[model samples]
Target: MAEVAAITEREIELISRFVVLLKDEQDALKRADPSVLQEIGAEKIGLAEQLNTLEADRRLALGITDDQNTREAMAGWLAQHPEESTAAVNWEKLLELSREAKQLHELNAGLVAMHLQLASDALTILTRQSEQHHALYGSDGQAAPVSGSRIVDSA
Candidate 1:
């Protein structure tokens, strides 16, 4: 049916958009831009919701009320409509892009974790050094020791 074809096109578009978003997110992570990353996260959330709705519509268009029937319906429809067989190709492309997006996300997460660990290590070193040193040198060029408090503050 025309509705099924339209839904398939919409799905391909959405998957393409998802792949683009994933690439943008990966770039944001690479640049270490928290604000940009947050913006990208919001965008990804919106896209995810859109994709979920589109998926439901697709299932409905294919007469697939349950997920178990999806493959069977899709195969039958493709067999009946040889002209629209390209939908299966598009579906394959979507799957490939989805897999790529997942891998990129995983890599981004690992990069973020590495950065966090580096920051934590640096903070630890700074805090340890600050704890060992009581105070800085006074105007007299002599080391000024504090009574009982560690001077240099860390968050």
Candidate 2:
């Protein structure tokens, strides 16, 4: 029998959302306040579990779940019916699937790098603006009366 090949739109969307949410979680973990780290950590873990469950469901729906169990069951069936015996499943298909999966992961990693770059650039711009404002303001834009010294902290 020919193999079934199908993936649902909902599954694809779920996977995409999971990737984006995971990226956000990682970014937030790095930048969140110390007091809120626990909340961020718990939320990330829960989102990860949801992603795993969705992926498992997708794999099962694709009829490609439980490779070891399938192999064992097939072996038993073949042994029980010698006349219907067929050669072992072609593993090349599995390899192809693995390669596709790796490609998707690479794509995801690239997206994460892009997000980081954009965030870094924004922070750089904001820092420069703040520095400019502070410099021109002369400490709240207050001019020193007559003669006075302004102290700047190196720290």
Candidate 3:
């Protein structure tokens, strides 16, 4: 029980940090700072890995296997040990924070997708303009005659 509480506390702390990191990611995305985004992304990945390990540890401490429904297991454990109300409250808070983190992650994904789409569109436009410019001029740097027009020989 003590071990579970400690693991839950660590999970909460890591998740809180993750939430902050996600917000920073959103700001970085808004500013289009690739360096900051890259750094924050690395940090977020590390936090996620840590959280996953802590979750596994918590499950083990609670005698819950991977196939068990974690929520049900937690509720059963909490019911069996009413004296550990703090752990129950912490678990609920952790769940809420996890949801918040997920939402922020989704929002960041959308922002990144939008940025990529805009970049692709700009590239397409530039490529088309380059092609048209090339078509308008010959290799000798002279205007290329239009297909429907002819050079008029004057007297």
Candidate 4:
């Protein structure tokens, strides 16, 4: 039981750290700071790896072999120790923060996609301007349209 309590405490700490990292990533995205984003991304990956290991340990400790068994295992634990209400609270908070992190990640992905589209559009415009109507005399003295290098596929 003490070991179970310790696992729960560690999970809570890791979840809290993950939430902080998510916030940092959100800030970096909002500011459009590439350097900060790169640093935060690496940190986030490290945190994810740690979280995965912790989760695996937790599952083993709880005798849960699959994700579907997690709720059942936790419920059994909770039933065995109704006095440990803090564990339930911590679990709920972790779920909440995890959802928030997922939403923030989706938002960041949308922002990045938007930026890429803008860059591609700018490149297409530049290519068209430089290639269209810029005719060169061929061997038969005929005008031709220069092949434009497009960032986006026409197909």
Clashes of each: 0, 1, 0, 0
Q: Report how far residue 74 has shifted in candidate 2, in Å.
A: 17
Q: Which stretches of candidate 3 lie over 4 Å from their true place?
A: 133-155
lDDT winner between candidates 2 and 4: 4
lDDT of 1 by residue, 35-129 (tens): 78777788888888987887788787776776456657777877878787567776666667778878978888898898899899999998987
Q: After superposition, how far is residue 129 of candidate 3 from its true place, in Å?
A: 1.5
Model 1, position 19, has a per-residue lDDT of 77
Regions of model 1 farther than 4 Å from truth = 66-83, 130-155
Tens-place lDDT digits, model 2, residues 27-56? 554554346546645764675576467546
Higher-scoring candidate on lDDT, 1 or 3: 3
lDDT by residue (77-125, candidate 4, tens digit) is 7788878787777667667777877887788788888778988999999
Clashing pairs for model 4 are: none
TM-score to true structure, per model: 0.70, 0.34, 0.83, 0.76
Superposition error at 131 for model 3 (Å): 3.3
Q: State the lDDT at 80 in candidate 2.
A: 55
C-alpha lDDT score of every prediction, in listed order: 0.75, 0.48, 0.86, 0.74
Sort the candidates on lDDT, descending order: 3, 1, 4, 2
What's model 1's TM-score?
A: 0.70
CA RMSD, predictions in order: 7.6, 11.7, 5.2, 6.6
